[model samples]
Target: MDSLNYLYGFGNEHQTEALTGALPIGQFSPQRCPYNLYAEQFSSTAFTAPRATNRRSWTYRLRPSVAQLGFRAYPLEGLKTAPLNLVTPPDPMRWDPLPLPSEPTDFIHGITTIAVNGNADAQHGVAVHLYVANQSMNSRVFSCADGELLLVPQHGSLHLDTEFGQLQLAPGEIAVIPRGVKFRVQLLDDSSRGYLCENYGAALELPERGPVGANGYANDRDFQYPQAWFEDNDTPHQLITKFAGHCYLTELPFSPFDVVAWTGNSAPYKYDLSRFNVINTVSFDHPDPSIFTVLTSPSDGAGWANLDFVIFPPRWMVAENTFRPPWYHRNVMSELMGLIEGQYDAKQHGFSPGGTSLHNCMTPHGPEAEVFAKASNDTLAPQRYQDTMAFMFESRYRFTPTEWAMQTPLKQSDYANCWNNISKLFDQNDKI
Candidate 1:
């Protein structure tokens, strides 16, 4: 037998018969070699190790060999591939509130801005929105679009109805909805809501930890995926999809929320905000607002971020010889801030809860006259800020005032007056 013949199962004359259609072993022999070894050798010798097994007739159909199936078992290539169809929800859909009958159950009203009509043009974009439920209406449905929707519920409990199933999100709970899914929200109690991020890039993935390992903010187990909810409702309904800048609504003859059975990582989920391991300074001054940035959309402009959604939640305000409130300054990114509850340390009175203020790109804002005076003269003791939660939706794009925002009576007439109080504190000797 030659070396090639020996490498294969073909040895001598007996193997030659096995190479033909005849069985390798005769009636006396117990073991029955299915294919003639010689023919199998002849057919497979031309191929490589992994290729040879695939070319084998019996082996090809029986099962893939270890080398041939290794890529399948270890899907490194698939894992590294980028996601297809990355999208952001329309900002207008967020403004549209679903009116429900008055009741005492869990009901909340939420307004989303970043998830609205924002687009990601070679950069990630973040949207800011709010939720206000009078504790009268129990729930509202949120039909998710073709991208990830991160819900930073500032206040109240949210019962999420997702394709997978339902999840109860309390205050400080952060939920993420994958693209192309429909879900609803049920307030566990009457509460106001504030959210910051609207991710348009890769799904709002858990922040990566290099070397340091898992040490801070939002662990994986803290995230809760809804249980499976399988329903067969054949009712006609509209499926609204937001792409580019417009909304495309398709009417389906059945409830689009129908996900009778699905099991995958690509589903809507929620996480507790309290679980965030807040990173802040204990000694000198307040860190940049970016510290509270639950998520950031990176921009092509070097270190500059496209959008940095920041929060000013109730926290310890105890930095000696330092102005406790956000230091007065103008920011390059446009800022749209909303007060969910309590007094904003920056403004003493006019910017009340539920009120909004816009500091367009490069506009100077922060610490109106009264707030500055109080903070400058007050004693520097360890003070715990209580009952206050304010959030900002900072974006890179220059936001043009919407016709409704600019023309509607809902616009605060006294917004410009917020700066009027500054003149009262101007001392002739304090500055030239």
Candidate 2:
């Protein structure tokens, strides 16, 4: 793999050109662009959105996007969207990792939706999917029209070739491809498996630092954006788009990744999870998980999130006189968690790396009974959690499992048994 160049800073207005002066110097669009390249504007937010929150980009391509045409419905099973016509029971759920493909399967063909919430047409909530692929998308490209894609790779490395440029992601890294951006995935290993979040809300932004000040938790400089790179191949290609809860295929006479130059903040970007400066409680009690949020899609309601991407990276714990592991609780926000590398501290077993667990709104969840018993009797010395990377997709709306997810053998039917062994320990005369 070639070492690619990147532009830095989160949400920075970046400019890059593969050829000298391919980008117009004076303004975003001029009457005639340099090298006679066509200028097109890609908007990720509404035109009337506030300046601080607006996201748009200008691309100088070999040919305008309009030239690529001819779209037809492409039926793809297992890939589902929001507002599914199904009922969701208020039960905690868990699943083993989707096994890798036995046959040759590309990223586009390996996606299987697990659960979804809110409405994609209304532009809110998210859909969770798992991808397992053994092949790369060589002549095929994909884009989502309904939402931005947040990819969390759990098994192998991926080489993403997009219109903007290329990004390489491994197990401990994440990448966000903006809505309507064309890209193809190339596996760097023999097989790959990971979790994907389709966020149909406002574009994700770095959460405000609040009293933690301006420096901790996903700093701006850590986000990496691809520099301009393009292929001028004229070979026939295919474009698969997920639009309005369905898949559409378009035949392209040539490669759509022909952008010679691009300048904007709306392109796909990646961040190393290890770069996240974790902020936590060093004094007494556990802080809300919001402290670990790397990015968030805000809703209309203040202090409420359409979706939040939070992580539980390896960190030290020093909270005295309190249970070190997460406590039992019920929450209004829905939570879907995935393990990236090692065992999650909450579950001693069954919750292996690449596995997933869901706790919908008001669904009770926490450490398993075995974990609780051990934590209760263990010493209170400060401990460091090592070799673990657990993360959660938290949302304001409840999740509805898809038919495939509910019927799949990977669904752990005995998930609730983890807490069944908790014996009653309350005593009337031994109250603290």
TM-score per candidate, in order? 0.63, 0.99
TM-score of 2: 0.99
lDDT of 1 by residue, 1-432 (tens): 101111111111111121233333333222433431111121211245343122211110111111111111211110111122333211211121223325443322234232222454422454444445545322223343334566665456566665446666655455666544556565565554545344554344443334437665445555555544534465654444444333444445554343333222345555445455666567777667766665454556654665555667677876777877888777677776766567777777666555567776677767777788888898988998777776666666544443334445655555556666676556878863
Model 2 pairs in collision = none
Error of 2 at 69 (Å): 2.2
lDDT of 2 by residue, 396-416 (tens): 999999999899999999999
Q: Which regions of candidate 1 are displaced past 4 Å?
A: 1-147, 152-157, 170-172, 186-202, 205-214, 233-235, 258-264, 424-432
Give residue 379's error in model 1 in angstroms: 0.7
lDDT (CA) per prediction: 0.48, 0.93
Candidate 2 regions off by >4 Å?
none
